[model samples]
Target: MTTAVAAPFRFFSLRVVRTRRLGPSLVRVTFAGADLAHFHSHGHDQSLSLFLPAQGRTEPVVPIELGDGWWQGWRELPDDVRAVMRSYTLRALRRNPDEIDIDFALHGIGPGAATPPGPASRWAARARAGDPVVLLGPAVADNRAIRFRPPEDTDLVLVWGDETAVPAATAILEALPAGTRARAWLEVPHAGDVQDVAAGPDVEITWLTGGRGALAEIRAARLPRCERPYVWIAGESGRVRELRRHFVQERGTDRRRVTFVGYWRRGLTEEQLRAAGE
Candidate 1:
């Protein structure tokens, strides 16, 4: 059921090949399909839209045959029958076998959770081999979905992300060229959630366990003096907004040099956030 939607983006039918628990709060799901032979991306913070099967269904219901009109057609499906679509970032892409890895942050799925697990979380937690899904992703190597672009003249790279953004943040670090000067702050809910990253010698990474908030810690720390520093931050919407303000207003960094994405809001689901045009 693969179909071309537009240039550089299309729908691909895929199935889960395996799932691994990265930590108490994360699960890594690997998917594969013949359509993946056409899937390509530069891979730094590459965004993806995943369509999951409705509860108790084995396959997702995506109207890929409609091509450009698939969105409208999908929306017209019954609420309980339509596939559940969620935004995720590409963690890793592989060839030969044609596979992609997506890391899921299991929000509210653990012990003593304050909230109930969402559909995505519940699905990822229970996903097994051969579970059918569909992905809307890039068909070209250098697509616009990647948001980790830094100016050529940049002297230093600054990165920050919470658990939800770990996969993207880590991918960006791994893709940095040798000798690139970079510093990163990755915040996770539990100490066990910190995974080892293979960054260049010049890249310094600090794993922040739940503690003083990211904004407070970042403000208290001193960054190396660099004339052209580029910043990338992603996490909750309210925190992302505050971090952007800190860099642009407080640190005097050029607004154009900073990239920030709010992966989620405190109280809003993806549907609600999109409806409000966030």
Candidate 2:
């Protein structure tokens, strides 16, 4: 059920141990597995690939037995039979029980939905204890997948993320040292989607919901003066690009000091975005 995919990254057969509703539009699913004994991560914005069971299946179907060829094998499977893969952030990692928490951003999942829920959203909304899944995750700490790296001379940290990036942004904020000065903007669909983040007083968090967009709010506010500020932004592709430009070209921040990741696009599914190499 588990197989090594590459150095520092491998497949782990896991099952949902519990689920909690973090907000109106977010759910936290905790997963555990014996395979987690080898799992390791530095935790700040750690990226993970989760494989959910295909429709009408009890467990995910990933051709891990093919070893290094599993990617091609899985991709070749019929759409209805292949496992649904989605990228997620490591919200929290726990010891002793070898469990990891992944926060899901629900969309079109409940009653009165305006659009059909995607495979991942549907699965997470109904996920139950003992539901089987698989994860392609890190086996070594400090892996490249953790992308919120600030330079040693960083004096201030700026973060912006939509609901999709909330987990990563919160994790980054919580991981900051005591004296770190950080400001964050988290945007969600509904006011009920805003959740409490435990961070030091030096970290100021702004929650945007049902109103102004992140770019507009950020542009209207004045940032604290700092010689070297590291900016991390993630959300819709177009929005992320615009924010990156604002920081690099308008704000005069060094391009290297800004880390921007597009968690999703406005009108594209993750698969489509990947296929287009976005």
Candidate 3:
């Protein structure tokens, strides 16, 4: 008898203007704003929420100087501590009206050792070009049967994940829809999270070694050049529920053309909504 879990989307504000290092642990933090066109993002693996202050930082166009009455005490936080935000993924979304871009995935200490910094990698390692950041979210990824619109006569695409789902697997291979033909499985944490994944049409980049899972050696050698295909996996939830039960009940495929997302749940945090028994 429970069913009220709505309201978790709200945003506008980011000024970190720049911060690079696409590999060795992913940073990329460019942003600006004219309310960033009231923020509307719907790219692959989209999810956001920044709200990072407490540093002498300033400028995603300046907005975090709260103190005297501080917006009426943050409108009284207590919808479960106003839902402790910090769930990333929106690797990119543009609108030069002001500007915006974001990408972050860092996890520290050996096993591909790189992501050192802290406090969200020292606010993305002292992001300098501009500053301010506290944008909310683009949320919406209940995975709605793979959330359509990449079906431009597609027949093959099976992107796997890790390293917190490789920035939505390189923003779904840079929005693969025009001449879509996929095959990217990155299970990184090392080998510099294997770069140069700027794809578009007929992509087939596979890099896995985040620990022996190239999706069981690409399903024991080969079989998906398309027999009518569509598969989009995301990082660890027991290896995306064992490749959605080995490609929908053992290679039968067609469970609405497959799109399994599990952003995280290896050692558990939100634990992929408690293993989907949510």
Query: Candidate 3, which ten residues in sequence have the lowest lDDT sum?
Result: 1-10
Top-down TM-score ranking: 1, 2, 3
- Tens-place lDDT per residue, model 1, 244-272, is 99999999999999999999999999999
Which pairs of residues clash in candidate 1, taking residues 3 or more apart in a chain or in different chains?
none
User: Residue 113 of model 2: what lDDT?
Assistant: 55
The lDDT leader among the candidates is 1
Give the lowest summed-lDDT range of ten residues in model 1. 209-218
Task: Evaluate all candidate structures by whole-model CA lDDT and list the values in order.
Answer: 0.92, 0.91, 0.62
- What ranges in model 1 sit over 4 Å off? none
Q: Supply candidate 3's per-residue lDDT for 33.
A: 65
Clashing pairs in 2: none
Candidate 2 segments exceeding 4 Å error: 110-113
Cα lDDT of model 3 by residue, 10-100, tens digit: 4565576667877776667878766666556566776565655544434222122342333344435433333223457767766656566
Return the lDDT, model 3, position 180: 69
Q: Taking the candidates one at a time, how many backbone clashes does each contain?
A: 0, 0, 3
lDDT-wise, the better of 1 and 3 is 1
Candidate ranking (lDDT, best to worst): 1, 2, 3
TM-score of each: 0.98, 0.97, 0.32
Q: Pairing residues by index, what is the TM-score of model 2?
A: 0.97
